[model samples]
Target: MTNAHELGLPERVPAGDDLPAEVTVWEVGPRDGLQNESSVVPVEVKLEFIDRLADAGLTTIEATSFVHPKWVPQLADAEPLLAGLTRRAGVRYPVLVPNERGLDRALAAGVEHIAIFASATETFANRNLNRTLDEQFAMFEPVVSRAVAEGLDVRGYVSMCFGDPWEGVVDRAAVVAVGRRLLDLGCSQLSLGDTIGVATAGQVGALLDDFAAAGTPTSALAVHFHDTYGQALTNTLAALRHGVSTVDSSAGGLGGCPFAGSATGNLATEDLVWLLEGLGVRTGVDLDRLADTSVWLAGELGRPSPSRVVAALRG
Candidate 1:
């Protein structure tokens, strides 16, 4: 598939159209990116990375996960990180919580926003969470309820929304069912994740159409894509054309899904910024600074970033 840049598309797609003029980038580098790395990054480095992201004008950043250290040891210091963080006005820091216990830790850390993850496929649910789909929802009920009661903004993540490694070609209806359940549980927004990076533009459009038909507004949805097959930017454009305003990406294409061995790093925030700028979409992010941040992070990771934009800039 040809990318938007390759097609020589116009800079601006005219206002008052189906596409939105502005987009919100939910940066997940500090959490999702680092969790998958083999080496454990220090708390100070993690804090600095997050600070740099906010400094680059990323408004929403996923700081870390509250899951047990047994599962994600890298982010075990979620509490300390939150406590030491320099909170900024109009900037949101969200943490991932697996259960009520995780929620408690997050609340104690003064986390104002949290995210819960679920799977659209049974295989992934069992492998990733060790629970059946129904059992997982049962586990999330009280967690979501408690978080909402505490006035915390809850975001739900539905993984393997398009195709699963174990089970191929997931039905659109199945994805919508899980998404609706999350919204029913009082989740303020749901992020649809292409965990294996197997989605095409047509598949993305069809799934969004199903969600819209099921009464889930596009405004309450965010799209997370992996660039394993080199389609992340194209898929994101498809989502934007369908009126999705929020996108979940990682700086420098930093991480991949540990559960899905075949997966690669996520859509690069720098690349997304490049595309959005060319399309005249406002993201409030400085593309050059964001790329420089990625380069610095890559040095800390002891490797080069996988982001195309970053590589080009370095050249």
Candidate 2:
């Protein structure tokens, strides 16, 4: 288990003398964070938000989702949002696609990178997707095939990979089985999400090690955590020790799973950037700039930020 102190963060830097050989952080605040806000942020505001994120040195940002407006009304202007996006050469903008219809819309928007999500648990799948586990797999099979055919890079997100609130606990076997399928289905990378955010570092470590022992390559896997129990960075360090290089975070800790009651915002991008920069890991991100972005976003949403880093910096 990662030390509880790591799980509970304060405004102090750790001495990581021997850092991982390489690490990558994906910023998802624009899409994942803002999508849940009740205030309607306009497409122009979203575009500028993304632009500021890019300028803050985050190379990868989830732009928006192509889901039905009824499901996520916050992102209803996805089309215009994409149209207004000022594409930087090196930055890759990935949009989330719920199903075929979602992917179709994304294609029309001329997106090159796409993300699809599915649950590792059967009950969660039924609840989250309104479909059975097998049915979810069936949906991804075609999405992956057609997406690749369109020359789009697809990233798969396996939600509730570690645990499920509804089911009480998630089986590692279930995660591995679904993970292998997603990889085989042509997903270039798979991000394991603690959707309800109940993962512990020890559990996260053991799971990665188990996958390694099973002859699965762990390099293509990423960790997407929520700070529900203040464990995201702790789990991140543990995953890094296990050679898991990619991590997903949100600016200002802005995100929550609407389906799960206690799920809160994701690990703060500022916090992650500070930790990694101190560790001598080059995330190519500007911490001060990211802090400003988070603060601006909180004001835009007319709410307080969930990120401790932002609060500390604001002072």
Cα RMSD to native, each candidate?
3.7, 4.5
Tens-place lDDT digits, model 1, residues 190-289: 9999999999999999999999999988999999999988999999999999999999999999898888998899999988988887778989997778
The segments of candidate 2 whose C-alpha lies over 4 angstroms from its true place after superposition are 1-18
The sequence of per-residue lDDT tens digits that candidate 2 reaches over residues 212-236 is 7767787779999998888998998
**After superposition, which runs of candidate 1 have C-alpha atoms over 4 Å from their true positions?**
1-16
lDDT by candidate, in order shown: 0.92, 0.85
Which one is best on lDDT?
1
Clashes of each: 0, 0
Clashes of 1: 0
lDDT of 1 at 231: 90
Lowest lDDT 10-mer window, candidate 2?
Answer: 3-12
